[model samples]
Target: MKNEDQAAMLLLGVGGGGCRLAASVRAVYGAGLHAVGVDTDALANRNAAAGGMTCLLLGGSRLSGHGTGGDAIQGRLAAQDDMQNLQAQMNGVRTAVVMACLGGGTGGGSTPEIVKALGEMGIATVCFVTMPFGFEGQARRKEAERVLPMIEESADSLVVVPLDDLLKDAGEDLMLENAVNIAEGIIAAGITLLWRLLSKPGFISLDAEKLHTMVMRGGNALFGCGSAAGDDRAIKSVAALRGCSLLRSGEALKRANALMLGILAGSDLRLAEVGEVMCEVNKSCKPGCHVEMGTVFDPAYEGRIELVALAFESWTAAVMAVPKSETEVAAEPPVADVIPARVGGRKVRSKGGSKLSFGATGRGKFKGVEPTLYNNQDLDVPTFIRRGIRLER
Candidate 1:
């Protein structure tokens, strides 16, 4: 990937859990990655800053940098207060990968506002949010669920990772701390794979432009990754990926309308291995699924193969087409050649216009009353009718 492309993308972490996740991804991807973390807790911000990521404290004056204490409303207000500071960090960024863990105050509350801000700035955002584990109790789960729709509304592509599903394969005896670490590691690895696919030199490159276009069309996505080594590493990696709980044991692929697959391996990777991986993945996916494949070679990945897949279930090609303005829509020919019209107490047929009453142009009894106006436009009449625009059938 070129430096310009890398500079255009940003990895943003919101709140404590989100900051930690961003730190993990940065640690794996190293120097070139541009990352920033925003949180209500001053201490947490300092810790994340220690990891070499730029950190900003939200609601420093109002909350005194203490934190929201799981109050999502406070978190939301904090983000709003410090929104300009966050926007300053987004100078040249065109695509933002936002990581947040829902259920907690900052993550649940601040994420929606931040994502919305990024969208308003014309930055494409792919949000990766983790839902609380079942063991975390009903309250936390409910909190996460409540904030989900808000994030979904603003994010271009949303990848939801339910912690319960993520840790299902871990042994029941696993410690809570270890389980959390493992989940973060797995998610970080998948994100790293995606970053490498776009930033590293590869046999077949998946550039930032392509990623932006795909994400614009990919409403919600499923992300998962797996690794394997030894003679049959490529095949084994695919099998492991198929079994990934995040992907619902390959069910996501079957239902996906589009997929972005990245293969990372060492210099010894064989041409046949690449073919084998693709072939197996293709078998798992439904017919007519759009697949974008890329391969990355690095010395660090010697003797192993890492496979990452992002499945977009709601992918639609219609979004790729440019939307028409009201003027353009109104200019289209009417569905019917002629329509009935009233003229001087006689019925007449009018050509090139539909008989459909798009909407009432004037207020019936309230016409003589004072009209409500906004920005110099009368709010009493329907906007289309006021603008003198006709609707096509």
Candidate 2:
């Protein structure tokens, strides 16, 4: 079938982690949500089936569902061998929202390949991934970081939430399982807000077309959702989101070039409160960001307000070739081509080994140009570096 004839938003779960996250999203979204969970683990796929996802067990010849045993390369190969099978399932998908927890073998390996396949078929994709927790060991962390750019390469935009940061506010008394569940809820909520903003109109409408424009313009991105009840709900929700470890609150929120802010509240929502929240969030962004805002009023949120913020760096245009609308082309700012800096004309730059302030440059390469040496193993670097793609200002 031709690309234009096939159309639907596919929520694809890549591996065990991805599939698990996908399942959670499917539960909240309920019926009418097109969701598929693909994995190399037969057991995991079975579990996903129990949760109402169409589970696709990939690469029968390679692994036979025993699992990847933490080998991402084998996971990648399995997905590659089963590309036709994966493509068969994507016949009508115009856009795909990929969910996965990175760092493990299956998710780390198969996600990029799946994303590449979608993009090649002219289907735009937005990826939401979770990095490993600090306690998950440096090996997993390294793997997650290594595959990041590869994921970014294939998807139109990427939203990465560090697991460790997501768990920062949870006290030591919180059980491990509960913490993990809460993290899942946060991710599910964030994407749910975006989906609602696009699919369901509110008092201040943010339609699907405008959303795709923002998502396509976004490169690497950050996502977070926070809610508060009772007094000062609006300000408190935005403040909570700003202080969220998952948001890297200060860093990611401040550096985003394009941002979509969604406010969900009850009919009792105050106009002044909305203004205060937007003002506070705008204060966090670099000056003159392209901010798309909307509000959804629900009786369910009588005394509560929730905030979902998705922010992107300028690099989102790196791989995306979509043509900007006439208005977009005409409204280009003076510093659009240059790497974005924080307000006050301050260029955030890291030298030697410190973390830089600029979002486009990324966390930092290392002490020098050397590949990161973790536990005596040399990590695989992105092609941009090997090809000497100019990354910094």
Candidate 3:
């Protein structure tokens, strides 16, 4: 990859709420990294540009009728579509940092598809998912659970950031915008570290396939830290740990000959969680490797855990490297039904798979739910051709 494409950022807006989150990051850091956003919504492109980043709108709806059978098929199609769209957006970038909010419509439904496509091309894809608070109740929970596995399965590494957790000590200043801002800060810091490490002397190019394999096997760990409670001492402790871990990580990268990294949140976490995160990261980065650190706390503005970071190594690479057999595919339950569901007022068929709803009882029946467009319509020939031609999947 050339210098222009070496450090790139791929932002995928999966759900209704994801755009705000993606926009938040783009708003803060303009131009240091190449930003590309994808959404099923037609407004996605506008939203991305408004946020000060470049983007592509896949133009679709979020609902696909419980994501099974036909929904799954559509999901695959959407994934293919996204890859094709993204291929043109890609400028031969070496490392791609993917950010998307989890749960909700497009981000949740389509993220896995994008990952699979990029992984096939040997590109390292790291996902940043903003999980809803349990307070949002069941609807969000099911969304998180459903998408979690897909994100894990498709990406090189995934860092899950719980929105509710970040708000624990947010004080009066905490709001959706501020929360996203915080998350973006943490994410930016994490990605910057990874980029710096990769650009350092003695670092060689890492194959995307190897990187993706390492992340899929749970070879990654998450850590959260923020000073929502105003505890600077505790915050510093976490920062110290992260710093040490980064140093060791760089060392490990040199020895293992690891190539790429995926960063989730730039900010949006507490300070106290850093050390524990680094410790866990070191453990996962190198199975038997150990890193030492200490912790501290403060009463005012208590530091807490908020963000998650991922580290990869040879063992993880090996786990991800081994290909799954056909039996492996058949053994697991289908994520959703394959048949399309009939949307009322139009010709639609139900997709088959397990149906899980998170919110409100009596709102709709889980079984035989109508299929909503990923953006609310069937794939047009031009769009379909675009995805097929680009992804080549």
Give Cα distance to truth, residue 157, candidate 2, Å: 0.2
TM-score, per-candidate, Cα-based: 0.81, 0.77, 0.52
Q: What lDDT is reached at residue 78 by model 1?
A: 98
Give the C-alpha lDDT of model 1.
Answer: 0.80
In the predicted model 2, the residue pairs found to clash are: 218-316, 219-316
- Candidate lDDT scores, in order, read 0.80, 0.73, 0.46
State the lDDT at 58 in candidate 2: 78
TM-score of 3: 0.52
lDDT of 3 by residue, 1-393 (tens): 355544553544443355555555455433455566666555545656676766665534432223322233454455555566677776565446566666555666667777666655545566667777666688757766787877666565566667665455455567777765665666554444443333331122344433333333233334343222345433443343344333242343333323233222223334434544554445434444322221222122233433223433322222332344545433322223211221111111112332533233322322233222222222111233323345456
Q: Which ten residues in a row have the lowest lDDT in candidate 3?
A: 342-351
Clashes of 2: 2
Ranking by lDDT: 1, 2, 3
Model 3 accuracy (lDDT, Cα): 0.46
Per-residue lDDT for 183-270 in model 1, tens only? 9998898888777765663776456556556655467788888789997888899898899888999999899888889888899999
Please, what are the lDDT tens digits per residue for candidate 2 over residues 349-389?
22223433323433244323322221222222333443347
Best candidate, lDDT: 1
